[model samples]
Target: MSILGVDYGAKKIGIAKADPTGGPAVPLTTLIVANQKEGIERLQQLIASEGVELLVVGVPVSLSQSGAELLRDKDHLNKQMQEVLQFVERLKNTVTIPVELEDERLSTKLANGMQKELVKINGDDAVAAMVILQSYLDRKKL
Candidate 1:
């Protein structure tokens, strides 16, 4: 059994994975989809091919008043959160595996500050998914 992590977005969806042994998470690939249909199809294929038993989806939450800085605006952040939850629900309907959400507040920023070579190869979205997945794995161990 393996676990897959997703950093879902409007334009691009990031992906990462880790073994069931609670090993290090690795950036997989970014899905550049034109619409939700394409995104879901690609995600399904990846999950099947990777033998992912669980799906860890990033759910952005802001404790500070600034909110998700990537979103820039509070209203936009709220709107995006709704869309993300809806997408997650749709994803759950399509897959039999257990789906979970992880807090991804600073994942994108953290990913941006990662190794330059990694960023070049995986892109920010995939790296962000890695960060989100690794966090979950770490918490699971403790």
Candidate 2:
């Protein structure tokens, strides 16, 4: 089974793909967040091209407990997540794949560190999506 992972941002959505038969995940081109319609279209294209069996989305939760300020941010994230959830739901309809979220606390930072030794790095968003996907793979194994 192949899986598509996404790191959603306000401007750019990072993408990565991993197959159960393939050894490692590879980054795909970032998608500019147009409206939900365009976002779903872009993902459907990726799904068809990559043969995705599952979809994983990153959810940015806080590093610590919630407070008044944290609650405010939490509410904002919740609102934003609704958009993503809607996107995933729509994607699942077209792709007929399992769609879910992985706790994406600091996968972005970790992916950046992993790429630091490279000669050149492209979009961090796509790399971060790979990190999220790889983590899902590892946990699924356990």
Model 1 CA lDDT for position 89: 78
Best by lDDT: 1
lDDT of 1 by residue, 20-79 (tens): 785699999999999777888898998889888999888887433222353344355577
TM-score: model 1 vs. ground truth? 0.87
**What are the per-residue Cα lDDT tens digits for candidate 2 across 1-142?**
5788898876788898887775677776689976767777788888888787788887665323222343344445677665655565566676667777776778788777775643135478888898888877787772
In Å, residue 107's CA in model 1 sits off its true spot by 0.4
> Which number leads on TM-score?
1
Local error of candidate 1 at 16, Å? 0.4
Each candidate's root-mean-square deviation in Å?
5.1, 5.3
Off by over 4 Å in 1: 62-77
- Give me candidate 2's TM-score against the actual structure: 0.76
